[model samples]
Target: MIPLAWYLIFSAALFCIGLFGALARKNAVAILMGVELMLNAVNVNLIAFWHYYAQMRSTPYVHGLAFTTMVFVVAAAEVAVGLALVISAYRRRQTPVVDELTLLKG
Candidate 1:
């Protein structure tokens, strides 16, 4: 079995990469992808901790799985709403670059 620290380090690295992608991009789609990556990293962490906790306590784990499922649901909804807004903005502004949007300046 893999150690808990390995999973933690991997999740941390994944989250950092996602953070960089989100912050260093001008395209709205790319930013959304980055956000998704970050969400996935969180899921990995949750599962890893859940497994370790169950092993240490000699009990079955269910709460972490439930929480992770909720996170997945929330992420899916976020993607749907985020893409819809991005598409609407693109149609109105003819650009999908985040820095070029000024629709809320009024």
Candidate 2:
């Protein structure tokens, strides 16, 4: 069986990449993508932990799976809302770069 540390390391790397993208990018869409990536990383961690702990207990793994599903649902909602706002901002301001949105007028 694959080791748990490997899964954790991979998830950590994914999270770091997402964090960097979110922090370094100026485009709202890119930032949203980064946020999605980070959320995915979190899902990965949750599944990995669930798998690792599944052996220790006889209980079903639905708890972790359900939580992961909820995370996905929330992420989708967040993406939809975030993109809608970005589109609205772009329509009014003509720029997707976040730094230009100082005044919430648009």
Candidate 3:
């Protein structure tokens, strides 16, 4: 069987890459994609931990799965709202650059 450490390492790398993309990207869509990547990394960790714990112990591992599901729901909602806002901003400013959104008086 695959080691648990490998899963965690991969997830950590994905999370870091996502974080960098989110922080360093200038485009709103790229930023949203980065956020999605980070959320996927979180799901990976959750599932990995659940698998490890469920096998080592006799207790149920539903909590982790449930939490992961919740994260998916929240991520979906966030993406929907975020994209809507981004679209609105793009319509108003004609640009997707994050730095150009200084005037939120609309």
Candidate 1 least-lDDT 10 residues: 52-61
Estimate, for each residue in 30-58, the C-alpha lDDT of model 1 and write its tens digit: 99999999999999999999998988887
Kindly indicate the candidate among 1 and 3 with the higher lDDT. 1
- Most lDDT-accurate candidate: 1
- Model 3 C-alpha lDDT per residue in residues 1-106, reported as the tens digit of each score: 9999999999999999999999999999999999999999999999999988899888776988998999999999999999999999999899999999765756
User: Judged by TM-score, which candidate is best?
Assistant: 1
Could you give candidate 2's per-residue lDDT for residues 2-88 as a string of tens digits? 899999899999999999999999999999999999999999999988887887888866777888999999999999999999999
Q: What would the TM-scores of all predictions be?
A: 0.97, 0.93, 0.94
Q: What is the lDDT of residue 66 in candidate 3?
A: 97
Clashing pairs in model 3, backbone N/Cα/C closer than 3 A:
none
